[model samples]
Target: AAARNQEKRMVADVKRKEQAVAERILENDEYAQVQEEIERQHRAYEKKFQDSLGRHASEERNRQILITKTTDKVDLIDTTGRGVRPFEPSQVTTIRDHSFGLGHNPRKSGKLLDDVIDMVRDKPE
Candidate 1:
């Protein structure tokens, strides 16, 4: 009877060891999965950053080209004292100085703008 109990105890100990090993393997697999996820997220972020940088560079290049074209047009006008109009559509830039009125209110500015009816009706005789 004592030998049978001893054998039963040994079997239980073996099963416990196998269960512990299985749990360790599962923990390792979970850690690996987490690591892989983190790496994938990092790679995705890097790719996004690179794509944005490329887009930003392209926009800057296009801006530079536009600035160059506008500058060339101005230079062409400066050489001609009277500013002759080109056969192609001319680019006319009119710069008007803007002033903020002493009692200017943005909310009412749109409503207070010159209306045709208001101007004709208030005409003094």
Candidate 2:
């Protein structure tokens, strides 16, 4: 009877130790899983942030291109207007010279003056 009781006690102790080991293993697994989840979330957030930054950069680049194109068009218009300016002064001089001609006819001079005025009126500001 004494030997049987000793064996039973030893078995109970072993079972308690095994239970403790199993609980420790479970806790370690839970901790590892939690860490993995945290890492995944961090990676996802970083990717999202990078994507947003890239999109903003792209938008800024497009906006800059639009501004440059608009500026170029304005400069081209200004240059075109400058090219047309010399003809205006020459037309005025022609009108003056024609008015002071040696044998000017009133009807012909009036028609010429009218044509010059029309040309000047058709020009943009």
Candidate 3:
């Protein structure tokens, strides 16, 4: 009878130990799942931040290109000295001579001579 009691006690102890081990495994699995979720959120945030940074950099580069183009246009206009000038009788003769001169070397006068000719043709009679 004593031997039978001892066997029952040993079996019960083993079962309790098994139940504790199962509980610990469940807790470890829950912890691992929570850790994985945190890592995933961190990676998502990092990707968003990098995308935003790239967009800002692209915008800055485009802005710089526009600024450079505007500066170049301003410099060209300053060098050419081509803008609205007062209509003078002497200027008419000079323009006519310039138009005649353009026939010799089109490259020298270029678009400026074309604009001058257009202005002369458009003048009120």
Best by TM-score: 1
For model 2, residues 15-121, the per-residue Cα lDDT tens digits are 99999999999999999999999999999999987886897777876766544433122212233446745333223222334444455534334655555456457
Pitting candidate 1 against candidate 2, the one with the higher TM-score is 1
Q: Stretches of candidate 2 above 4 Å error?
A: 55-57, 60-125
Q: Which ten residues in a row have the lowest lDDT in candidate 3?
A: 70-79
From the highest TM-score down, the ranking of the candidates is 1, 3, 2
| Model 2 quality (TM-score) | 0.43
The lDDT per prediction is 0.56, 0.61, 0.62
Residue pairs in collision within model 3: none
Sort every candidate by lDDT, greatest first. Answer: 3, 2, 1
Higher-ranked by lDDT: 1 or 3: 3
Q: Model 3, residue 45: displacement in angstroms?
A: 0.8
Model 1 earns a TM-score of 0.47
TM-score of each: 0.47, 0.43, 0.45
